[model samples]
Each structure stands twice: as C-alpha cells, then as structure tokens.
Target: EAAVTQSPRNKVTVTGGNVTLSCRQTNSHNYMYWYRQDTGHGLRLIHYSYGAGNLQIGDVPDGYKATRTTQEDFFLLLELASPSQTSLYFCASSDGDNQDTQYFGPGTRLLVL
Candidate 1:
C-alpha cells in the first residue's frame, strides 16, 4: 500500500478563518496531489506538484493554494476560508511510473461554520 498521511484528521473553523492542511507521502513519489470531495462533485483536484517547488494549478484553482516543499511533503493552504469550502480533503501520491495508479491518504474533514 501507498504511504500517505494527513494531519488534523478533522477541523472546524468559522467563515473567513484561515486553514492549512498538511500531507506527507513516504513512498518517494514524484507526483503529489490535493483534492476536495463534496456531495455533488465527487472529487475535484485542487492543485498538484511534480516536484519540490513545482506547483501546477488544477481544475478548481480558486480560493486554494498549495506548495510542495520536498518529495515527501506537501501542504494545502486556505488563506481566507469559507463555508462552501467545507468538505473532505484528500492527498494522493503517484510514483509517475504508471499514469493510472495513485495512492490516497485517509482524508481530512473540515467544517466551516
């Protein structure tokens, strides 16, 4: 199995709060991703990185920012959080050897009240 983990398994914040979700992959994967899961939208990619310091904007790039500091570490930042952004966030990693295979962390549940 893939070794990916996220911090603050659950979070609660008010509107306009600042939130940060952290992830780390121990598989030495070259590619890492951040995604959000909602009721309607099953899962939407928020951002990704091919390597350290390389940021690639995903389909949903607004109100979210991310950074990959090392091969094993990636972080998602929500500077000005909102209620609509409350959802289950996930972090995934891929070795890049296979285009179809990826490993996902459990998930981080966030609530904006």
Candidate 2:
C-alpha cells in the first residue's frame, strides 16, 4: 500500500522565522502535492510536482516553496513565515494522473506567533 508520512506532527514558530515540513512516501508515486487546511478555506493547493525534477505552481503557491529531491521524498519550505501561514499542512501523492485517490499524510500543524 502507498503511504505518506510527515514529521514533527506539531510545530511552534515565532514570526519572521523559517520552517521546513518534511514529507515522504513509499509508494513511489509520480505526483506529489502540498496543501494547507484552514478553518473556512478548506484544502488549498500550495505546490505540486509531476516528478522529482519538475515543480508546478498551484493556486496558493505564494509565501511557500517546495522541492522534490527524489521519487520518495518531497519537502515544503516556508520562509519569512507569518501567522497567517499557520495552519495544518498536508502532503499527498497519487500513483499517477489516472489515479484519482490522493493519499494524504497525517499533516503538520504549524503555529506562528
């Protein structure tokens, strides 16, 4: 079974700090995505990639950056972070475009002061 996992399930950060949330998958999926879940906004796309070397800008890519170094690993980078960015961030992956089911990680909760 394909599984996506995230680290530091909980996080606390001060304003103007940098935070990195890690995500890894064992299914060797071809597509990976980063999204943030807010109270009323629901799941909003941040960034995604088709493969390790390719990155595609998503709806809310601002204030966030992402990179995929390998097929099994992908990372989300938050620089000069703000409280507005504080939310539950989830990482998901699919076997391919034909696969509609998105396996999501537990998620990382970021709290900014």
* Candidate number achieving the greatest lDDT relative to the actual structure: 1
Query: Residue 32: error of model 1 in Å?
Result: 0.4
lDDT of 2 by residue, 1-113 (tens): 67999987999999999999999999979999999999889999999988887899999998998999999888999898999999999999997867478999999999999
lDDT of 1 at 73: 95
Off by over 4 Å in 2: none
Query: Model 2 lDDT vs. the true structure?
Result: 0.92
RMSD (Cα, Å) for all candidates, in order, is 1.0, 0.9
**Per-residue alpha-carbon lDDT of candidate 1 for residues 1-113, written as tens digits (9 for 90 to 100):** 78999998999999999999999999889999999999878999999999999999999989999999999999999999999899999999998776558899999999999
Instruction: Report how far off residue 45 is in candidate 1 (Å).
Output: 0.4
